[model samples]
Target: MRSLTGPTVETIIGVVVRLLADERGESEADVRDELAEGGWELPIDSLRLVEILVQLEQELGVEVPADVESARSMRSVRAFAEVVLAACTTSDGSPSS
Candidate 1:
């Protein structure tokens, strides 16, 4: 998980929307709206969702394991934040769980 120094879910959600907008040639606000009104499905496709997670991993100095079941359930910003937090550890790299 990443070390969130700000409003965790809000910050990450903004990042996710911005990344999606950049990848899709759209505006962040549009992406945010799409995300805000969601079903179990994400605003972007599965590939884009994975890409967002990967970007978060790089930006936050965290490794979102490929086999993490919760990682596949990022239908909402808070849920995705929880997944990232679950992967957050202390000084070393082992899972804090």
Candidate 2:
């Protein structure tokens, strides 16, 4: 499900893993392996999540919505990457024609 005009999920996930690793002082490979196993909860709090999203927006040049669903999606790295991918594809968070 690669977006035609947006960052791929893998790219977003890589960025996320890097950010999480930097925040937690862990290696990117370690963080990525944990996420790859599934059912892994992020150790970050809401504030740190917001900071990551901000960094993502800057790095990816996409505006991530600050909303309930987005907040909920931050529970996992994959989920958050999906949200960021979605944001990259849409101007107002809706499907583009």
Question: For model 2, how does the per-residue alpha-carbon lDDT over 1-97 read when each residue is reduced to its tens digit?
Answer: 2234456788888888898899889999998788767675666788998898888887887888888878888997878888888888785465533
TM-score top scorer: 2
Instruction: List clash counts for every candidate, in order.
Output: 2, 0
For model 1, how does the per-residue alpha-carbon lDDT over 5-46 read when each residue is reduced to its tens digit? 533556666666667788889998877777666742467667
RMSD of each: 4.1, 4.3
Clashing pairs in 2: none
Taken over the whole model, the C-alpha lDDT of each candidate is 0.66, 0.79
Best by lDDT: 2
**CA lDDT of 24 in candidate 1?**
87
